[model samples]
Target: MDKLTKGTWILNTTKHIVDVAQKSTELNYFETTALAGKTGVFLSKLVADKQEVITYEKVKKFARESSIDNNNRNVKMHLDLLKEYGKVDYNTKLTEVEVYCFSNEDAIETTADIYSNEIVDEDEDINIYSLEETYNVPRKREELVNKLVNNGYSEEKVNLAIKIQDTFGLIKVADNILYNEYTFTGNEAKMVKTISNISSSKKKDIEEVINRISNNQGLIENKITSDINPEIVKLMEGIGLIDGITVTSEIGEATFYTSPHIKGKGIKEKDFSLADDVFHKAKILLSCLRFGQEKSTYGRGKIDTRTKMLNIIRKLNRGEWLNPCTAVGQDYKLLEVDGVVRVRAFGNRFQMSLRQKEVGILVEKMILNNSIDTTDDMGDICSLEVQPSGIIIPEVRRQQMKPKEIGLVKELRDEMLTILRT
Candidate 1:
């Protein structure tokens, strides 16, 4: 099998790759995924600016602007990394480059909607579970196509839908079989029912809070009342519908809450053991993102630092620990003086983790307090099932969020917005 070269740093600077990958620092399990994230922001901007098929030189210029490893060689490596992750489409021949565009596409009813609604609205005798089973069970790609076609969808449209969903990482097609990764089961299915059962009297307020947290990643616990009634929050918590992870620092501590369905990566319901490491790693990544924005990493310039930071944060997956070198390269030492991050030696090399774990939740609170907008890339590790109307299981959606559903989350200022606010 051919070896992978994109996600790691090639130490042999003398050797250029897209050609060879000898003597590389592999990022397979050691948490260097942030480099691809950083590179994604660059690709987003490059596509936005060029607005057409880009050239090789444009990619190089953007790479040079990055604060993370801006060498000529690293540019090629970063592009390859993004390509592997579905962020860009570059021609290896180096003439025409097509990057994944970040612009929002108009909301049109999707093929899932078209087909699923056709069956249900028409009152077909087909057992819905049978239809769902057809989708959930891994089957030959040809079989699924024939099923969709037999159900009356044009073969061409069905093929296009499969292609689009595949590209969006919503499904996986391998060896002629289709696997839908967005299939909701276990706790995720339970969440759909929980959210659906919210009392109409409180639905307006509660769904607002739940939807906001689900969209913006999560919220600090004490801040929940600012958006909804305290009694409502208590009820939700009592029912195991919502929970939090508390992070501490020398100064204080704060608990961030969200439905278990939308909590950041690695955090699980009833899984307190992972919260410490998960939030701690989130803190380091958040701090490093802040540092990058302040230093104009990716050219954020004199814009709102919190918003800019969130933009890059949205591009990143919070669960992946930042590479120690990547952290230090972002000048994490400056943050250490402020007690934001901690650095220590491990074996022959150094390791970094967030000392001010409170900073992660605090920054999230700040963004809420200031009314900063979270971009489409809200950076939450989990995907919410956000279909407007459909059978919840077979047509479950992921990653995509509707604008009206994204409410502005608020922070508890002076602890005045406590759960007893009403």
Candidate 2:
């Protein structure tokens, strides 16, 4: 086979392995971390050999040689971002995800600093900050509020500040701890409703946390990422074997540790060769096992519906409602956001919205029940707790079209239709 065709076949092969590995890891937490760390090193070496810049073609070449599939998208995405944003100051606005994806430490730090910057008090603004900065400032809103009170910021002001911070950005709070980062004109509340981390005040013992998480059904599934198990890490660290070290995460009674082993020589091992080996081994082992597991067990979706519903509400602060699938196309194009949204991939396919789906089901229910006798009363939501199938068709009357219904449907239909077109 020629080079291009050979590379495509190689990528196709790698994708299958990755898909299987993602599925089987039950307690495969340690493995993925090792995989990431090792992969980072491997990529870095390749970059170093090429004088520090890996183009899309080079990455494709590497993808073929390395037998890894995920980097394909990362390479393209990073190149696009670098082309668009260029080299910028390190800030927290960019996520760890974007950081690792790009293999750009400067970019990662720029984004990190942006996210980690402290929240300002009520009065401050007119500075340019990212939605990332806003969402992450009040990361642990309740805890930050409590911390503010401890800082003598006053319970009344601190609580109110946190509430606003949760909805607004860090710059918007009237009183900010990040005084150094000031602008001429104060324009706080830069963005609204961004995904930031949550801080939990109620510290649970490892045993307590594990028990709580285990018993909470979908609560653990929804709130906790499969990649993490904090309780497990704590337990492992508490054990005497590994010491004088650092840990990145602990999930479900599993702990990840990395530290140089001290020897008789005052300056023991400075290199992380041992740690590197261990990490890669853990990753491959986990990858194999995770690849072996059943889909239902691995998937978070199989959790108890009630628990899933409750946890999602608490986590996202909103209930999920599915709009009925009036048209279930062979292809689904999910609408991630409205307005000018950046999408790496776009095409005709199935569309989905978490809470929006419920509305469609309610509409379908009205139609199926024959409650909607006329087209003018076409606005419907089909809530199907009763039906197992996800086929939620709206109850709009096909018999006749009211002027108002036609206009409304035209607008709404276009919205859904736009996603399908893409």
Candidate 3:
């Protein structure tokens, strides 16, 4: 067979050559296959003539003779792959292309050399590149793959590398790449090392702490000692896991709470209260009552209505007496009677109340401790007084007030005021 036809026949028969080209050039399967067909045709001519070098013009001539696209554009595109894979040495400025013998041995050696020589410094900063830009550009893909592989990662790690790149950008990943030894600074590095050193059980414990903090929207870092493992706490501090959270260390110990600005999702400061434990219990009871034995709603597929009701409960449980003006509940209307606060869910009117004596004691303590302001004349009017029938709510005369003033009295209805005094 003639050289051109022989080349085409060899390309069709040998698939491994195309696979090598694909890996070396970081091209997709199809592009590398097409380029391999054209390359095989070109190689046949070089082998037959015993030539090591071909001018750019000769490349086009050979392409036409071999029934490959003869256009300079098509020939140049195919030649680019050969150069990238180190199969051929072609310079953009020079019009000559030097051919290397097509063999798997040569291909592997050359690509490995290229990778070793081009490996980036572990500390080098990588400019952020969007996934689209990296995928579309062959050069960028090769650069990433080479860097990752040369750093001791296998081909299987490519997806993981991409995910890291997407999350922290290439710069952070490069900084975090473990070389001969771990080289990083600050809390994040320390935390990573700490996590690596701990047992799997401890790791799970740490994760649980994070989940609890996340679920509670946040907690005082000090108050977090209850269920958390101490080793995990050390790791957390090392990693600055609670960075950007609200920190209040004055009240005996450092308190770390969630900040809406940082975590995107966390409990707002206003949503938390001393009665959080009680609110949580009440929420569980209500959810259980509403969902009953239904498996779906009780688990991962919980309804939004349940979530909203829990939030409302949290807000109401902030130890604030719900007068008519501020008694707005998203899915429920709140009622205070005899020192007990009741929540009636809007739909189905599902009702639940806090422990009556516990709530009354808390409210009384708050008033006596002056934690809640009772300085207004209205406060004097409703001041707590010891009576035979329990703490009695002082009366406000309707006739002594103007029309708008009467509305204020009406808002603080007898039942709500009675709860406050009691």
lDDT per model, in order?
0.38, 0.25, 0.33
| lDDT by residue for model 2 (34-125), tens | 23322332232232111223334434443333334536465444334333434311233322111122222322232223222324222111
Which is the leading candidate under lDDT? Answer: 1
> For candidate 3, lDDT tens digit of each residue in 101-144?
43322322332233233433231112112222232221234456
Candidate 3 residue pairs that clash: 220-256, 221-256
Of 1 and 2, the candidate ahead on lDDT is 1
Clashes of each: 0, 66, 2
Residue 227, candidate 1: Cα error in Å is: 4.4
Cα deviation at 160, candidate 2, in Å, is: 12
lDDT of 3 at 82: 57
**C-alpha-based local distance difference test score of model 1:** 0.38
CA displacement after TM-score superposition, residue 101 of candidate 2 (Å):
13
CA lDDT, candidate 1, residue 119: 22
Write the residue-wise lDDT of candidate 1 on 92-140 in tens digits.
6866567654321100111112222222321121212212433245556
Best by TM-score: 1
After TM-score superposition, the amount by which residue 198's alpha carbon in candidate 3 deviates from its true location, in angstroms, is 8.6
Candidate 2 Cα errors over 4 Å, as ranges: 1-50, 53-77, 85-104, 110-143, 146-256, 260-422
